[model samples]
Target: MRLRAMVHRHHVLGPGRVPALGFLALLATVLLAGCTSQGGAENSLARPLMQGSTAPRAMSPVERLANDLAMADVAFENGDAKALANHLQSVDLAGATPSDANGEAKLNAWRSSIAAAPPAMRGRVLGPAYLSGILAAGSRINTEQVLLGGKAVSIAAGTAPRDTLRLRIVRGDGKIVCEKSPAHARECRFVPTYTQRFRIELYNTGPEDARYHLVFD
Candidate 1:
């Protein structure tokens, strides 16, 4: 997907907190693997846009988790309130609190911000995780655990020649959230870009090449 389109979607979607949480939930399932270097330790889609640097750093597991989690944080701040609330319904508030009062305050603020999200976005918040979870449950798919930076990143295996599978994320009522696209986070199993349409790419990450297509949609 074009970066501009992603920016537009970011705006239209309201509080991105839910999507960010969805991203985190996915990560939780795969947090065993350390980080991988896409560009560098601090590389994120936002960094270059801010500093105008193209240099890539090898991301440590810690850095990748921080970046992904931070991306969700930014999204939550900008997203609608109602969706944020619904999303928070599933979160463990006790777990969110930090030992320090300052940390607790920050967590509380995050919770409040989500509660302030608009009603329209409430149902859409869980779409990404719901869709992905459903896919994981329905298939006898392989899940890989890798460390990126230091955080565990889990990726569901794509058989034979493919290493990735793209999924269209949608609300239970069938609203398009995002499409699977090339711009998705490297560790993401489903890219949220092609909402109404989906394309699954299975890579032969293994040495020997294999081929298969359209056995199932």
Candidate 2:
């Protein structure tokens, strides 16, 4: 949603009418759970809801990362420090390489930002509908899924920035549903008229192995 939070019936609530800050202190649970190994890596305050987009769907880890970042973008534009703090907890700063090439200093800056935010906005949540695998050079992987009728379907995929990955979605009869040329990131969206299976094809045209992650909602 919009990363907007409102006090509802005496509680701070975010998308899907879920409690955003049950109490500012509860956010610590999210930080410890998502950033650490508490209750496993997937524990959180809530998984960002895509309920209307699919029947009881959960965002995959990759999808949740994308959604949280997307929400963080909105928070940044609107100067919603609380939302920014909440959404960013999902980022694995401990293991991430900074695109800025500033190394640990850059990551520490991010940690400082998160640490400085008020206790209320320091948590992250994501759904689960993702696929990931390694593709050898010049190899392809085919996957299929059943998308029910009357729901908006969205899919996002990406590979290492240096890889050339082409993605295509096709129907049983060979009709192309969506296609993306060689690139680092791709997305597809549609609303099917009826329940049906669609095939997803990922081709690695690069000269080395490529790992890909695809998420849907």
lDDT of each: 0.36, 0.59
Candidate 2 deviates by what RMSD?
A: 29.1
Q: Residue 158 CA error for candidate 2 (Å)? A: 1.9
Q: Write the residue-wise lDDT of candidate 1 on 89-126 in tens digits.
A: 42332112132454345446656675353223232432
Q: How many steric overlaps does candidate 2 have?
A: 7
lDDT at residue 82 of model 1 (Cα atoms): 57
Give the number of the best model, judged by TM-score: 2
Model 2 pairs in collision: 58-127, 58-128, 59-127, 59-128, 60-127, 60-128, 60-129
RMSD of each: 34.1, 29.1
Off by over 4 Å in 2: 1-88, 91-126
For residue 171, give model 1's deviation from the true position in Å. 45
Model 1 segments more than 4 A misplaced = 1-72, 114-217
- Return the lDDT, model 1, position 49: 80
